[model samples]
Target chain A: MSKELIRLRDLVMEFDGERILDSINLYINDHEFLTLLGPSGCGKTTTLRLIGGFLKATSGEVLFDGQEIGDVPPYKRQVNTVFQRYALFPHLDVFDNIAFGLRVAKVPKAEINERVHEMLGIVGLRGYENRRIDALSGGQQQRVAIARALVNRPKVLLLDEPLGALDLRLRKDMQNELKRIQQALGITFVYVTHDQEEALSMSDTVVVMDKGRIQQIGKPEDIYNEPKNAFVADFIGESNILDGVMLEDYKVRFFGRTFQCVDKGFERNEPVDVVIRPEDIDIVPASEGHLVGTVTAITFKGLNYDIIVEFRGFKWLIQSTDHCAVGSTIGIRLNPEDIHIMHKSEYSGMFGDYSSYSAEYDELTEDAGDEEE
Target chain B: MKKNNAILLSTPYILWMLAFTLIPLGVVAYYAVTDPVTGAFTLDNLAQLRLYMPVLGRSVGYSIVSAIICLLLGYPVAYYIAHRGKVAQKMLYMLVMLPMCMSFLLRTLAWKGLLDDTGIINNFLGLLGLPTLRMVRTPGAVIMGMVYNYLPYMILPLYSTIVKIDRRLIEAAEDLGCTPVQVFQKVTLPLSMPGIFTGITMVFVPAVSTFYISQKLGSADTSLIGDVIERFFKGNNMNLGAALSLVLMVLVFVCTGIMNRFGDDEEGGVVV
Candidate 1:
């Protein structure tokens, strides 16, 4: 097994008597690009701050390579952080900003110059050593911030939405750059972001969090396809959740139809929530498909169209290249293997009971199949 | 369209400025150079320049010393106010600026009463069975009065500038392995320079021209250029007063220029 670079065991953090990070237990392997994905106020940034030693945990221990660092000050921790605002020193030029920590350590001037130049090259900013941070573009400033943090050569680098300030195009560019840098340096990267797409595109492990609790932790594909809970399914991306009963070990029904889901945890006739990703669904020929629905609306989305199909009384948002006009009668098929089922929570609010949903869907599917004939 | 509208709107302000400001300055300039005996351009009044030169130098010296005194005393107070929590910071600043609402002359008179040989301070000291030291009618009292009168000017600007400085910069400095002292030296001091420069200008210019504070707080020997100008204008020698005013105005310009040069293009700091 790969040795864990950083481990947070039962780490609980609080602010003003309210818990911010509730009993967080996460272990990051060496050189893993682990992303903590959450919406704003989900305590992801607080998690990063805890790892960076900027804030103290209320209870629990943070271990770096097996040593407890409960009371370590920020400078003493073997970690560095890149803040969202790119908190670069305004008085220093690009080179000096990168060399700040080294100079503080009283490293020789010749060595400082060498390291600064090396960092400049690493961030693809070789000739920008003399440039003022303000003079550079947002993308350039972000690169400088990264280089500054990385130059310290910490065991783990915590980036608190470091690309949040950059525009969409630049954010995408930096996402790829960060991934490449993580691989090249072989250092643990704990990135925090509200953008699920950014986390999915770049991270080796994505930890979905909600309100100081972990929803799921898995690889990108698994988190997208095999989300373990209702919150994880809903938070990571768009999903059509239809509440139904788990009729048997492998069968589940929603929106007046039984969908063959491949999950095993359920008693017979127990209520279960069914999750179907929009992309996993398609408008198919009515004779050969699993479930059917009529097109309520169809809108263009660059390469493909967002097709909103009505099933039973509920609606299923289907993404496809098929062009279906609004109010068109269209038969739909939800791929069986794509379905996910989970235990219900009172806090999980979306679809109601599924018996009525199935009845409504069957009526719409029958109408669409007749239209196709 | 925007440019035309801006220029048109600025016309009234420009006219008011030129009428009240530029014309009076022109009148002062004419009087400063006009020959008193010949009624033509001559050095007749200029011959009396040496008589006022020492007083002018004294004014410069007093303003510099008092401004430095205010700066040293006000910096820590302003920094303390800027760093306190929201409620405490506001309350402290309110107390610091409370003196501004009171009449300046009343406050000066109160200081006079407090500093007198038989005043409350001396009485209190005597009650403590301690020697009542002489304080009033001295240069020290004058400097004290000047500092008290203009302290708010030196503090509020410094407080505003210090408050805007990002606390994260200091935290970042500490994170880079700098001690608390190094953090202040590397981050806090440089970031607060703009406020310091502004505070200096605010205190220095007023202290140099303030004659009333010196007259009330010090002996006749401590008279400043403002006192001389007041005497000349009162004696109906407006020309001499105008000449002194012109000299004071030039000194203000020279001092401000020196200060601006020192603080120009301050990093992470507002210059104006």
Candidate 2:
């Protein structure tokens, strides 16, 4: 098992009596890529800042290697951060920017030059040393920020949405590049982002948070396949969440029909939120379907069509490659493993409905979310 | 059409500059190169500048001292005000500027009142059985007057630039292993160079050429180039006054040019 590098115990952060992080307890294993995934104002970035020693928790302790470092200043910590905006020094060229940390530590001049050049090669900006910050493009500046932080060789690197400003293609490339760098360096990386896909693709462990509380923590597959609540189910991916009652172990009642599911251990006859992922539902013939619905809208995504179907006046988004005409009657099938049952939470009924869904509206909300953080 | 409209809108300012600034400058240049009595072009006025070199040197010395003192005093005040909360920053900035709303001569005269041999301070000291200090009509008094008059210029630009610096840059520096002092030395100080240059120029130019402050605060031994220029003009020696003014303008130009070079070097090269 990997050793723990950093642990936060009962950490609570408050600003003006309003809590931003509520009793957060987590341990980061050495060489693990852990992502704090949530929407804006979800305390993910606040937690990252606490780890970086930029902010002290209002109460509780931040333990680095089993030692309380609550009073340690950011400059004294062995952790660095890549800020959301990159925050490269505008007055310094690329070489000087990457060499800043070494210069501050009074490292030997020849060693500083060697390490900075190695970092430049790692970030793939080999000959852009003399280029000023504003002269570089957004992506190049982002690489400089990463290189600048990584050149310190800190045990833990905190990244707060480092790819948030990049274009789609560059963001994708950098996502993979970050994972490769983390594996090669064998250091802990605590990344924070609101992009669920990025967290799922790049992290070994995903921490889902909301409203200043961690909702769940698990591997990416487990967090996606067996969410702990409606919030996690809805936030991780598109889900059709319906209010349901547990009939017995391995059985649940929804849409006035009892369905077999893989989940158990709930109190018999307990009211629960049932989650069915969009891609998990199979389009079948009406005769063979467990339930029937009417298609209301169809959006042609690149790989599949996002079909919104209305069943008993409730809309559900379904991803299917089959082309079903608008206003046509359709059927969907869910297997025992496809059904996920979560305990009733405060977030129940707040999401999982696509009645008012539109692609443009989703994009608008995502843009607004970016600005809020 | 848009370009024409822009030029048309600037006509009043263009006309004002032509009538006031350009014409006055041309007249000064003309008088500096001409003999007053003969109305003939000659360098006699420029040749006489050597006679007042000591006065010019003293003026340069006093202004440089005042500028340095202002920088040392105003930088901390500017930095403090910039880091304050929004409401407090606004109030402090207004306080810095409040003295400037009054007339410059009145303010210098008020200092004269305070620093006179039997002025309020000395009278108060005498009442307490303390020795009366000599303050007015000294080099210190002149330098103090210049600093007091021009300190707001130093603080205003410094506050603006320091306030505009992104707080993230400071945080980035600290995260990169810099102590608080190093953060200031490596980041905040370099970024504020433009403001420093601007503040020095704003304070030094007026302090160097001011005649009224020296007149109110200095003895004959501390007479500056401005005093000599004023006396020449008052005595109807227009050619000599214009020549001194021309030399003063050149000195200010060279100083600002050197400051701009330092500022540009700090700005770094833009890789087009």
Candidate 3:
């Protein structure tokens, strides 16, 4: 009767004394599309392996349907994994390959044939029953791998960057295809990828990780618009982080000026990083302004112009519909609703004691915290 | 490859085949169908083919039996070596080759001594109060020599084949719910067919043409084709010898063709 499908409790994984995954705790809800997003070697694949029962956890327990499966081999588990290489059996034709698991389970021959055809139809490989695996194109082969995994009707599916070997265009198209499949089946899906755009577009919950730790877990919009720490804000999308202090409950200071921001959860005078998305900062005419600055450069970004402005030894990359040429003075205004104030813990690591990381950022936020004084 | 350049690239190998294999067979052919005194065609030698065909048949039958034994014994040894660690593999490979360092005559002599009527095995049988076994100068001795001479030939190729197969293919089968036995049946055996084919051809073809192993171990009554060919050549019957030689060459070609046609393409794996 429980809705939770998988629970990973404080999992720790180490291989030969090298810690790959450190104390990971999470739960996967039924029918949710979740993504484990991180850079390479951040233990995303290790986590998936632990859940699939391929690798045993050092300390934690993985419960599927309220049953502990720490000692079970991968085949006995109800979860199935699609490897990056597609791992198709080359000797078996398309139909035999899909029927492999069913036959192994001692299913009746007639039923095995029926399920195999049904699976092939589901994966859009209806007519490729007799094709050799090596003879099929890369895209068609991927479909067989999917059908092979789904034929047994696993309760959850884990894909370890299955599209990593695909070309960019094919990978993008498969991303949408995977989403469609998950929606149709209503099965819990755990996808792992380092591509930020792919994670944001397809995942219901994006769990961002770094350096063997979970940084944040939230909806895609919250992770993008309101990052909790400097790491999350920077990793999710580009943000112009500025050093600032909370002047009052409703106001913050940056760029030698005070601006009213909607984020208000700190004592007075706490150090913060102000995040304003490129689209949030408007490029107004020079006469009307919250702050006036000179445009250092302009870049054409297909639909709009990215205007780089300098003021008070700070620079901001603002995107706007009203075009501004390089070397022109411009007025800039930060929309309070779009202002994301982050704590200083995240940016300290980036700056290496806050200098080398942001010499570029220093020019962008030269007047930080002056509005309060 | 383009047609012109493909032929150009193959010229050296083609010429080499022509000189060594085709040229000798051509001479044998010419002599098999000719009268030495008149350079005229005669069935005199061809008419004697019926007399030697039975010996040819026995040789083929004997070789197939010995090769089967070689395969059955060699397969497990090759599989163990291929799956062994790097150091173990090298050591086992060297052990297999050590017997080859001595001349084939020496190895066959040792086998003859062991299987003689009053030899070590018969003496042991007498001591055990069992009937003194008959082993030497019989069909068994010829088979023993065939298997011993070519055991390494069978092992080496089969080991290399099994070692090169993609282990992931086997793992994929097991992961797809195959019991270990089913995995071997569906994946390992099919993948290692090429290695079995290699070992069989390497052993059987040479064993059929073998004269020394048979003569040393078998009785005079065993009329194998190898002994017949040996007698015709050594006894000054050149016409009969040339005819038998041509027959053996054709058999080799036919066997090689079968191997090329049905050898395991997935032999990129270890001999399981």
* Cα lDDT listed for each candidate: 0.81, 0.91, 0.80
Give DockQ per model, in order.
0.56, 0.91, 0.39
Residue B149 CA displacement from its true place in model 1, Å:
1.0
Top candidate on TM-score is: 2
lDDT by residue (tens digit), candidate 3, A1-373: 3388888888888888978778888888899999998777778878887887657888889988788888887667777767767788777899988888888888999999899999898889998999999999888888888888888887888887777767779988888888999999887889888777888999999998876778888889989988878777766766767788888787999777888889877889887888878788876777888889888777676888766777765667677877787788888777789788877874443521222323544443332111100
| Ten-residue region with minimum lDDT total, candidate 2 chain A | A364-373
lDDT of 1 by residue, A1-373 (tens): 5678888999897888887789999999988999998766778888888887777899998988898987888777777788778788877789988998888788999988888889889899998888887898888988988888888887888888888777878888888889989999998899988778888999999999878887789999999988776767766676778777999988988767787778886899988778888788767676665666677766687888767777666677777987887776777776668788888875355432223434543442231111000
Candidate 2 residue lDDT tens string, A1-373: 8999899999999999999999999999999999999988999999999998888899989999999999999999999999999999999999999999999999999999999999999999999999999999999999999999999999999999999999989999999999999999987999999999999999999999988999999999999999999889888878889999999999999999999998899998999999999899999877788999999999898899999999999898899899999988888888999899999999999878888879533852363266234
For B1-272, candidate 3 gives per-residue lDDT tens digits of: 59999999999999998999789878889888987677788778878889777778889998999989999999999989988899999999999999999999999989999999999999999999989878998988889888999899898888988898786566556567666688878887777788888788888788889888888898776658878888988887777789888888889878866875677553432221
Question: What lDDT is reached at residue B195 by model 3?
Answer: 81
lDDT (Cα) of model 3: 0.80
For model 1 chain A, the run of ten residues with the poorest summed lDDT: A364-373
RMSD of each: 6.4, 2.5, 6.6
Error of 2 at A4 (Å): 0.9
Residue pairs clashing in model 2 are none
